[model samples]
Target chain A: MTTQEPTNAENWAKPVDSLHIAHDLPDHAINLNVEGKRVASMTSGFGKMWQKTYRVRLDGARVAPQQVVKVWKEHFPEFWQKGQHFFGPMASISPGDVALINVKTGGVKLSTGILVLYADDVSFSFMTPEGHMFTGMITFSARELEDGVTQAEIVALVRAQDPIYELGMMTMGSGAEDRQWLHVLRSLAAHFGVEGKPTLEKICVDRKRQWKRFGNVRRSAAIRTVFYSVTRPLRRKEKTRASA
Target chain B: MDFSADVRQIDGLAVIDLHGEIMAGADDALTSGFVRATTGNTGPVLLNFADVSYINSTGIALIVGLLAEARASDRRILVSGLTDHYKDIFEITRISDFVTMCDDEESAAAAAKA
Candidate 1:
């Protein structure tokens, strides 16, 4: 076993003017709300900031931390719940890759994407882009505990991107977000033949909302998705008439 | 390289000199240094990354957490001595949007005074 020095700088993605999803995704993967969008961080969000952690310890699984992370990155999308679709890039989950996401929540389908900000042997992270439901970063990691247990964890530090998203978070969006990650962890553990029960910890980092960011609603992905869905028939008809 | 943080006062500013590869294990030292620098201090805190060798995603998140703490308390944070590469990383993460980035400790002190 060789311990490699962490070349952190090289592992990070180069700075981009805006996100561009270069990956060719499946037909089911909606690529909206991603291209030409800037990556949004905690400072650009509208609602109160929160740091959420979901952890699942592979109790009886015989896997090293690095092995767990490798598998997690390789099968990244496979762990997602049924309604959520993750379309990874051709090169897999490397840093700077842009992946499309199609999520179905409460019977409403929305499209968004994330920038793979950083990736290493034992961990990786993603940063949300503009018009995303939240403005933040989520890190996935696997580490060996003191008792020799390999623990897989997901940590999200985020804030709602706009007032509408904030309201939804206050209602059903927050629980849905929680369940999504929890399900992913459970599924990952189950993939290793372990029935892992995930634990969650939520902490509010900041109580004050950034009212200035309320204008971010102008780029709301949910609204755009709804509009796209409602006008699909009209677009199809126009295309047919033009071809005729 | 292991992470180490030393907090000191320079011209009324709490300047934390960080040395090492900042990864997951850096949470304790980083958080303690931040708390030590900001406790009872009304002025902006300067983080000097002149000697930093590496910084992973976890390290970035730790810095973001510190920034959140500072913002919550109405305090400011200024960063200095980041290599051009790290400067770009900060920009990509949008940490540059909230904190002032300086070329060196001297400039960071001057910015804090400003």
Candidate 2:
């Protein structure tokens, strides 16, 4: 890790102000924001998909892409166990350029994808199982907010699409997918040490409310079916009894 | 392919100790050992992993299958002596929530008795 500040040119090429969009045919688009500013956005056309976004501020300095990859591999070896290889060559990373890896492989049926972002003051990534590909972005910037602590905001916008989302709809309700997204966010926060703060707590609570709303809908449907079964026969019996 | 087992009649617990790497081709032996421990035994079983070196996904599936069988038969199954690396992997997959963890053979045996 280097403590040196990123040069002006490096920052300008991958500008802090502009948004970069990347998408392949039939894949999802990814959108990212840097320092609370939109930097990149991408969108994909896959039916029923999964998306995850994560951001974190590092205290020491920016770590190189290789080092970041090394750390990730160490922490998540099982991810590599399924034979998903790392994309691009390792030597292509320049001084300030962040490396992005889109993993596509493993587990059950659908093709899973993982996107990794490595930067000086922040690192984030998203992982999804098959049929669910994530499209999201991460931005890194620093500002002097308080005297000592720096204010770093990492926001993740994720959605479940495709089979899992559809399965959730069939089994758990529409909001079930949203609850899964909440778990993804919490897991990302835990990985980056961004959890336990008041803001994150509020975010989780909001997700919980969505889950409960969908749960209520499912419960009501179940109750309606039970009620219909119990009343239909009774009405017929009463009519017969009156005719008799 | 190293496997050992000791059946304690008083406690009605079977402790099976496995060693070496557990991968795809070697799962049958492991599965057989687990079956031997549980068959005709109406009590709990504890898998002692103190000597085990590594386990792949297939190995994990075998263990889960054994646990499922034990549960179906109203018998409890506990896993004892996991290394930190194994523990971390299990935690990531949420497998620890499904299986009981014990510190040693004695604790596993005692818990099985209860």
Best by lDDT: 1
For candidate 2, what is the DockQ-based docking class? incorrect
Among all windows of ten consecutive residues in candidate 1 chain B, which has the lowest summed lDDT? B65-74
Q: Rate the local accuracy (lDDT) of all candidates.
A: 0.89, 0.40
Off by over 4 Å in 2: A1-27, A30-244, B1-10
| TM-score, prediction 2 | 0.37
TM-score of chain B of each: 0.97, 0.82
Looking at candidate 1 chain A, the ten consecutive residues that score lowest on lDDT are A1-10
lDDT of 1 by residue, A1-244 (tens): 1123335666899999998988677876667999898998657899989999999999999999899998998889899998799998654589999988899765567899999999999999999988888998999999999999999999999999999999999988999999999999999999899999999999998888988899999998888999998999999999999999
Off by over 4 Å in 1: A1-6
lDDT of 1: 0.89
* Cα lDDT tens digits for candidate 2, A169-201: 435443432343344334433544545231232
